[model samples]
Target: MNSATPLLEVEGLRKSFAGVHAVDNMSFSVAHNTITGVIGPNGSGKSTTIDCISGFQRPNAGRIRLDGRDITRLTPQKIAKAGLIRTFQTVHIYEAMTLRENLLQAARPFQASGWVADFLRLPGMRREVDAAMVRADELVDMIGLRKYYDAPTRILSYGQKKLVALAAGLMPKPRLLVLDEPVAGVNPTRIREIEEVILNLHAAGESFIIVEHNVEFVMRLCERVIVFVGGSKMTEGDPKSVQQDARVLEAYLGIPA
Candidate 1:
């Protein structure tokens, strides 16, 4: 919460399954309002690291700080409530629901109304609904999904559905958004659109930690890149420097040293 503190920090993070270390003493920090990318090869602990940070998996030993507050042992729901939102590798939109409904549902947890109020349609509930709708409208427009606002998400293309998911994540205006493989299955053109959307959002004061297998995409979007190898941070620097590092080539890209 100090102006100079990193938005998120992980210190000596370590996790293992049956004695096999997934993230071994990894330490990293994501600066506020900056796009940071994490890239690694197979079995390099990328998945486990994010899982620990996001609270899906607890670390055997480590500390995770968000907004300069310790959140290392919080539950997934608690962590989400703390404003560290993470999207999955797969699309998470509700196919049967309209695009508008999906975005509104994403904010249900933050509405400050109890189920009794919601069921009875109380004044507070109604006011929250109106406010959520305004946010939904802004986000739908931002993601360029306004035309499909009332339409069921089931009919949208895979790329379009992904966009809907992105918009839903923004509905809460989280302190930091951790994107997991956002462009993994998206097409080339859609990838560019996603990139532009991220840049626009960053310009508007949003920060992100992107975990992606697509090195080229990460290089284009992130200000700093961290390469993981042997379950720890192998090297970290600007995209150009990380890309040219021989260790990254040998360890991540599978090119012989």
Candidate 2:
């Protein structure tokens, strides 16, 4: 690894569910302004590793760092505020809310006031709400959802739902985005659209660590690839090199390389 610190780093991470080790001693780092792909078979600990990094699940052992600060034990919301955001394999949006409303909710700052702000409707609250809407619209346009900005999210198609998920992830203007299967089960037409959005986001100085099973998608989008097998690091490198590695072939059930 280089001497410069990576935007996000995982070291010696270990986690288990009911005695099965989902992620065992895993370690990797994502550098600034770079796309790193994480690929593994079903149950190869790809999602489990993301869970630990995003603070959704606590690891039994390991260290996680963001910009050299240890965030191993922080809450998910706190981690997000620190500029590390994660997306789910399944899009989670407010079905009853309009696309604008859902995006506005994401733009709101973490309220130190919490329920107090809601109860009292403190001064300047309305202004803050307005600002959030403005930001929300800008993001909605950027994610190509402007046409449905006022439409209820429940009425959107699966591909549109995925687009909303990407919009929501960008609400906070995160430094690092952890995408969990951004293109899964979608038709080929929509897959291209999602891929374009991801590339545009990357071009705009946002780093990403994407967990995907689509080998072609992963190979094309990632500058570097990390392969995991049986919950541990198998091999990692540039696209052509990593693809030809013997261990990588064995891990993914490919013919001997």
Candidate 3:
């Protein structure tokens, strides 16, 4: 693990609404090629924190860095270009678009094709399309949604839609992917599948910051787990240690023992 420079870092982040602080002086870091899990109860600021990181919502105060460059106030599009991608708790997929089309669209921003080239059907545009198609195929298969590659996403189940969103995020091959509640409403079997998909991606050198409500899922999947309570980071450590923390049990996650 590269300890000198983290892949992503957030320090002294603060967000508020109507005089209520959703995240107060939040701070953390995610190293390259490692998965870090963030867990907290409702209103603990897990989602709010990620929103700020991903540029969905601006923070009242803080610093966010990606690969040592500040991205605290950058737009979401700019942030994605800097190698950070995020998936929402609610699956965000084009219901009428074919799964393959959805994935390709997500990758368009990173492709070499310009608007002029695409409009003119230039060779560069075609080449980029071919490359994106290849990546789409790989991601679709990884998510076990190959059969739905040509099907409209609206026909998929809720869990299946979540998988599509995950795949779309991977199409960009981001430096860090933040997943918000990856398995929130998923069934046990679907959750297991999602776990396998994440493991496969991790083995291939992807880094992630997963903000999930499922304590067991986070514990089972992440190497390090950070617990949040009442909008601030309570503690962070290995999964086992975080799971056994008395404060975490009594406050957020229920006692496991």
Candidate 4:
């Protein structure tokens, strides 16, 4: 890929369920090593757009490119293997597993060997598992979950679970991480923690596309913001300009700019 090429691009994207259009003629791009925010009113197709981009839902018409290669028709698993991973609004962690175990499972997808080696516990497989454990511990420490490393995920608070999910998404070292509402229901402190994690990751050269309803949070976190209304892009710009746009304020915040 060229240095100037976008990390991810969506062109003329469209999706519909039954007769209702969810994402209509949407288009955007996420640059490398940048945090881009997507915000809109309810039913404005924010989630739908993400689903299409991440391969959770197939678009009726559009082109999706990752690192300059077409990935519009790839399966979710294939797309993930291609270094694009996403996390949902609901934290999806193994309730009965420890944080370390959860992180290990997330790393399983990137394992070079097949399950046959893992099942047999071969020397190479054991070495791989050990290395994965070390990586998991590093991730746990990075996300500030080292204190609960051995605790069952069920015992952690909701916000902590969100952190675990975020860390899990990073386990594969994806080029782009699509986060769906990273701090939707967390407390203020946890929200700040999540924000800090995002900023830290961005600083470390990870790219992100954040879909959030928290306008203030988006303003504080994202460099570029895209506003959606009626299943299409209303406007896009820097955080300040997007927030100050009359169309964005009216369509997204239900207030005049």
Candidate 5:
């Protein structure tokens, strides 16, 4: 792709369930190495948009492209392999596993070992396992979970589990990371930590598309914001401009601009 190409593009996207449109003619583009936020009221199709982009729900019409490659028909696993990773609003950690183990599992998709070799513990498999472990350790430290590295995920607080989920999404070093409600249910202190992690990652050349309800958090973190209302694009701009938009204010706060 050329330097001018967007990292991700959703054009004329539409999805409906049981004759009700969830995402209707939505279109947006996320630039490379930038953080973009999507926000709207409940039932406005925010989650549905994420689901379509991530390949969890196939769109009935429209196209999705990553790095200029059409991916609308791809499966979720294929899309992930093509360098888009996403996290859900709910934490998806394995409660029985240690923090380190959870990270290792996250890295498994990128590991080079075949199942047969892994079952036999061949030399190559051992090396792959070692590499995965090193990566897990690094991620543990990066997300401030080093203290809980050996502890079961079930023992961590809700906020800590969110951090773990974020770390897992980073394991593949995706070109675009889609975060859905990343700060939901997290404590104030953990929220700050999550913010720091996002900033640090973006500084390190990562791109993100965040779907969140915390307007203030979105304003503070995202370089661009997209507003959705009733399953379609309402307005989009930098944080200040979007916040100042009359339609956005009316939609979000029910106040006239």
Candidate 6:
């Protein structure tokens, strides 16, 4: 791939926790409008690398560039404002709120002033609330959760909750969406539905980096796969080629190639 313009680039990324290098000297570039899969065994630093890139965690050493702008030390909120967002493996939806309200809350803009202006129900606040509702509705439809929009999120199944969590992440309109085990614990029926929604979003001009332990499912959705082992990059290539690489298998299985 040409190096002139990449949507995202990481170089020499490293992170350590309790004397263990969770991520070590990893480097990769993601082209614009591409779906890249990140696969590795549990504790292989897959989530750590993503956290560093998305600003949930800072790397001990590395460079994170988006559209050629360095953002290594940016805060999570800053990263989101800059169009990078991530969804965790664990769900974060509000149990008491309806799916629509949850999405609406996520859609609201970041505001420093609190309580006083909101309590008064100012015109600007009302307008923002209305806009949030509209955006929430659109996202609900896109995620195929329109029927459950007004329902309490507590009543949704595990897979449905996962979908709603993903939709909530998109409410901020990120340029790159990083997902961590998006389909983990999901039922077989909803797995295909999730894939379809993700693919449709990709087709509509979104880039993604999916971190998953389920290699086969990721291979089906991603054009290229990057493998990590012992907190460093092992290999990366098209799914077919990467899967056939003896080194990749060794990395996943803890054996020599």
Determine the backbone clash count of candidate 5: 0
TM per candidate:
0.97, 0.91, 0.96, 0.96, 0.96, 0.91
Candidate 5 clash pair list: none
Q: After superposition, how far is residue 226 of candidate 5 from its true place, in Å?
A: 0.9
Q: Which tens-of-lDDT digit does each residue in 1-257 have in candidate 3?
A: 34588998899999999999999989888888898999888989998998999999999999999988899999999999988999999889999999999999999999877889989999999999999999998898889988888999999999999999999999999999999898989999999999999999999999989898788899899999988888889899999988778888877846553
Compared with the true structure, all predictions reach lDDT values of: 0.92, 0.86, 0.91, 0.90, 0.90, 0.86
Q: Measured by TM-score, how close is model 4 to the native structure?
A: 0.96
Distance from true position, residue 147, model 5, in Å?
1.5
Candidate 5 per-residue C-alpha lDDT over 1-257 given as tens digits, one digit per residue, 9 for 90 to 100:
58799999899999999999988999989899999999999989999988888899999999999999999989999899899999998888899999888888888877788889888988988887788787777778888879899999999998899899999899878899999999998888888889988999999999999999989899999999999999999989999999889999999888976
Q: How accurate is candidate 1 locally (lDDT)?
A: 0.92
- How would you encode candidate 1's per-residue C-alpha lDDT over 184-228 as one tens digit per residue? 889999999999999999999999999999899999999999999
Model 5 Cα shift for residue 143 (angstroms): 1.8
lDDT of 4 by residue, 196-232 (tens): 8889888989899999988899999999998889998
Clash pairs for candidate 2: none
Error of 2 at 29 (Å): 0.7
Per-structure clash totals for the candidates: 0, 0, 0, 0, 0, 0
Candidate 1 lowest-lDDT run of ten: 162-171
Q: Which candidate is the best by lDDT?
A: 1
Per-residue lDDT of candidate 2, residues 80-198 (tens digit): 98888899999888999999988878767543435677578876676677777777877777777888989999999987898888888888788888889988877788888777878
TM-score of 2: 0.91
Residue pairs with backbone atoms closer than 3 Å in model 6 (clashes): none
Model 6 C-alpha lDDT versus the unseen true structure:
0.86
